[model samples]
Target: MATYQIKLARSDTDAARHFTLELDSRMTVLDALFIIQREHDPSLSFRCSCRVGMCGTCAMRINWMPRLACQTRVETLNADAITIEPLAQLPVAKDLIVDLGPFFEKWKRVRPALHPKDKDSKQLAIVPPDSEFGRQAQVKRDCITCGACYSVCGITGSNSEYLGPAAINRAMLRLLDPRDGNVDDRLAVLNDETGVWRCHTQFNCVAACPKGINLTDSIMKMKRSLLFPKKFHDKQAAT
Candidate 1:
């Protein structure tokens, strides 16, 4: 076991505090936080659920990178100390917790819910694994709505109205789905400046996503649809 220093940025009071912990090398960042809350300061605040990567609630800025606390092992950080801060580009509700309202508002604006064109089809359609749509859907569906992509997005930081990577990624999933009926509406939403056009293609979102979703590529796909509307529309018609 070794003692390490942890600096936590507390937004509630607009200050940061340092805490020291003696932990095994195998212990995770979340484990250290738990120890701090229990032994050092019960008043310390953070959010987490599932204690696993699946629940994105534990996401924060660790060592200047967005990551799930539960998934980040202290040993892998290769440092004697670490810094913890709330997710970027969002209002910090408290220590290590940012308001998710704006993130979800943009998510809702993209219309993430599936609107099936053929609701009458009772039989389940089997999408071939080798098909283009099938492959794209599989890749895009892995997003757990962790907000890491949004946290690291530069466009979202500068443009408050800009729909971040997560929203765009969600839109891409539905856009690629053949059964979705609202493709035209989604396309219109994405065509706006605050939508796909705002992305600088910096690829920060790609790097930040813990689920490994290729967000930049997905955004580019949406941009291509806008650039060549007729081709995309015709393809949709052909399907």
Candidate 2:
């Protein structure tokens, strides 16, 4: 057992609340939050679901870094005190829940759904795993839309109109897919001033992603695609 001092930044009053918890070293921040709410303050509001980290609903600023509360082990912090706050660059809905509306809004702008060329055909367009775009985009496809990338992004902090890393990565996935017919629409968004051009390559999103996705790479690829669209289109078509 260890004693942890949890400092929660409250949005309602723009204040901080301190709580003392005696928790197992293996316990997660989400577990501590639940204990705090149950035993300490019922009004301490936060959002969570699928405590195993699959839902990505428990993302928040833990120790000044965006992370999944459920996956952050108390022992791993190596500190007696922990600072918790809502994700930056977003409106705080309550204590730790930031409105993900802005994040999803950019996600929608990328048109994430697959618009296949032959939607009426029964055949599937399958690119082999050994293909260039397939291998490059495979690891990046695990984004759970947690907004961690958005929270840690430097561009999103200053430029709200910028399509964020997750959204851009979604666009990259579609762009690499030969079957997707809406490439022009996605490219138009990414080629805009507020699109991939806004990213400063600060790589804050890369460091903050719990899924270990290389979001910056996707942004760079899109930038290259914009410069040489025919090459990317030929590669996609060849695959």
**Which predicted model would earn the best TM-score?**
2
Q: Which 10 successive residues of model 2 have the least lDDT summed?
A: 230-239
* Cα lDDT, model 1, residue 236: 61
After the best TM-score superposition of candidate 2, give how far the Cα of residue 210 lies from its true spot, in angstroms. 0.5
Per-model TM values vs. the true structure: 0.94, 0.95
What TM-score does model 2 achieve against the real structure?
0.95
TM-score of 1: 0.94
| Tens-place lDDT digits, model 1, residues 29-75 | 99999998898878788999998799788889999999999999999
Which run of 10 residues does model 1 get worst, by summed lDDT?
A: 230-239
Over 4 Å off in model 1, which ranges?
12-16, 231-239
Residue pairs with backbone overlap in model 1: none
